[model samples]
Target: MSWLVTGGAGYIGAHVARAFIEQGIDTVVVDDLSTGRKAFVHPEARFVQATILDGERLVEAMRQFDVTGVVHLAGFKYAGVSVERPLLTYQQNVTGTVSLLGAMEGAGVHHMVFSSSAAVYGTPDVDLVTEDTPKHPESPYGESKLIGEWLIADQGRAHGLAHTSLRYFNVVGSGTPDIHDVSPHNLFPLVFDALLGGRTPRINGDDYPTPDGTCVRDYIHVADLADAHVVAARRLEAGDRLEPVYNLGSGDGVSVGEIMSAIADGTGIAFTPEIAPRRAGDPARIVASGELAARDLDWRMRHGLGDMVASAWAARKAAAPAAE
Candidate 1:
């Protein structure tokens, strides 16, 4: 059965799409190219250039591709910027999800894997987040993602839809030199860009309560995360029941200080990171347990921080000329 992959040209989406291809899964991609690059789409997969907001076109693509399942990843993903552009965020995230569900219904495609975010647990009190963590989203971005999950659940109950939302935290690194995280707000790209541009990357704070006195976060390799997606999709195709949500996380986490060290070692760029004041509401640590995911979806940290930084650096450096 062919699967429809929304946002397949985006950073994470591209990796997921490629992983599906490597697994011999037939795939079709739909992306508007708002934040995705056309080059990221695999040559084996069919591409549809359109936004999810365009419901009719989305349905047409779903039907034309003979899609039996879907992986929904298209949306506005910047949490910080959602504050300044709440309307656009909802339009692209909430409304767009609804439109996608409608398209799926129209095409009779029932199974889906939603690309959710950790922002849905904004500033959680627990050191380790779980699937059952109380969602107290602080930003429009988080709210929209939670809303998307709710929409999926409701649709599941009413229309017999099979779906699972995968909540991701601090997705970093590259699976290949051809693909890399390009978001300005992502940690890896921010540091890599600064170093590539001949500037020292700065850390916001170093006085946290953690062991290293810096923020600790779960950073899973993109390839690992993509593999989990393929597993979930296969489970759905096999009619296996799955959880409503799963977190693609690392049980043990790395600190920003540790990551900086990795970067230094990986790139051979030696310099102390400039420490700036912590941005308001920034927490000292936020890691998650991947026990459930590991049990069901074969989740694991296949690559270490050094691998993450080095692969990302290689891709980012390779793309520098085009970026300039």
Candidate 2:
């Protein structure tokens, strides 16, 4: 049996698909290629280009591939833009999840690993966020993710569908040079774009209460994040119980200034970032404790900040030619 990965062609989803392939897990990728790239899909896996909203198609694909589980990652993920497009965010994230779950039921697929977000804990007041942290999502995107988790849990309780949700923070770096983050909103791509275009990177705000006068956020490697998903999926497939939700994060925090410094050093381009005024609702610091995930999912920070920077830079540079 294979696992169906919705949005498997995406930045993080591609990494997840790659991890599954490496672990000798048969994979089936279904993507509409909205923000995802077809080039990122691995050749060993079966690919079906269709939106998750199409329940009939999903059921057919799952049955065709003998899918036993699902790794659901398809969604609209821009928190800032989600404010302007709440309807679209909910339709894609919440509605799409419902459609996927229905299709899974139709195909008798009972396992799922949902792709959740740290945005669910928007500007958390605590020093280190945990699974028990109070959820105060500030945008439609975050709200949609929380609602998705609720739907999954409700489905599990009613239908015996085993599942878990993974709340990811700032995921960076690359497992392969061929696959790098292409999101315009992400820090790595934003900085890489600025440098590649011969412009200085801009920091959103540098007057925050953080030690470095900039916002501090937990940054986890995309590869490590993918591994955790695989572990969770494996456990679910094995009928092993898991926490309903887990934060896939690095307990340590890194400031925006430190990230710029690392980028400069990694790319060998020395320039100070232009400081922009603070955006409304921006937090000074937001990190998480991965202790629970470490105990259950074998979660570990295999790559440090230096490794994150260097690998991301290498991947960005490798993609520069094609981008031009």
Candidate 3:
């Protein structure tokens, strides 16, 4: 039996796909290549060029790969852009997931690992968000991800669909030299680009209520995140029960100021980031406890902030031409 990884050409999806392949799991990748680079897909994995919205193609590819489960990672991921283009966001994340689930049902692929997001807990009031935290997603992107989780839950109730949704926070760093985060809205990429081009990177707000007067958020390494997904998939395959949701988060949290320092240290640059006015809807702190995931899914923050910055810089430097 093989696993179908949607959006396998994207950075995070590519890492998850590579992790699956390295672990000796049969893997097949289906990506639309809309925002994903074709070169990012793991060469070891079988690839199909198709969107999750294409039910016919999804079913055919699943069958062709003899897929037994799915790792749903394809979505319109930008929370900020989702506000401007809510329709497109819903279509990609919400409707796209619905279509993928339908195709999975058609193929009798009951097990799925939905790539949910921390966005589902928008501006959480609690210092440390747990899995039980009430979801109050702010943007259309976050709402769509929550809806995707609901869809998976509804399917599980309707049938014996063994599934789990892994809620990710600020995913950073690279698992391998060949793959790197390329999202324009991602913090690391944006900072790296600015620094590489001889521009000062700006922090949205440095006057928040946190210790460092900047936003505090969970940042997990891509390799560690990918490992969690692999273990989660294997546990499901082995009939091991898991919580419906898990937070792949850093319990202690790292402030934006700390991240800036890490970037400077990692890049051998000495410059304080420019502090711009606070972005709308910005929160002071939003760390999450990975205790539950650590217990069950082998989730842990193995890489330090310095490690994340260094590895990300290494990968970005490796792809200097495209990056510059």
How high is the CA lDDT of each candidate model?
0.92, 0.94, 0.92
Tens digits of per-residue lDDT, candidate 1, 272-304, equal 999999989998888988989999998888998
| Local lDDT at 254 for model 2 | 96
Off by over 4 Å in 3: none
Candidate 1 — worst ten consecutive residues by lDDT sum? 315-324
Model 2 lDDT per residue over 1-324, tens place: 999899999999999999999999999999999999999999998999999999999999999999999999999989999999999999999999999999999999999999999999977889999999999999999999999999999999999999999998999999999899999899999999999999989998888888889999999999999999999999999999999999987898899999999999988999999999998888899999999899999999999999999999998899999875
Runs in model 2 lying further than 4 Å from the true structure: none
lDDT of 3: 0.92
Question: How many residue pairs of model 3 clash at the backbone?
Answer: 0
Clashes in predicted model 2: 0
Residue 166, candidate 2: alpha-carbon lDDT: 95
Q: Candidate 2, TM-score vs. the true structure? A: 0.99
The Cα RMSD of model 2 versus the native structure comes to 0.8
TM-score of each: 0.99, 0.99, 0.99
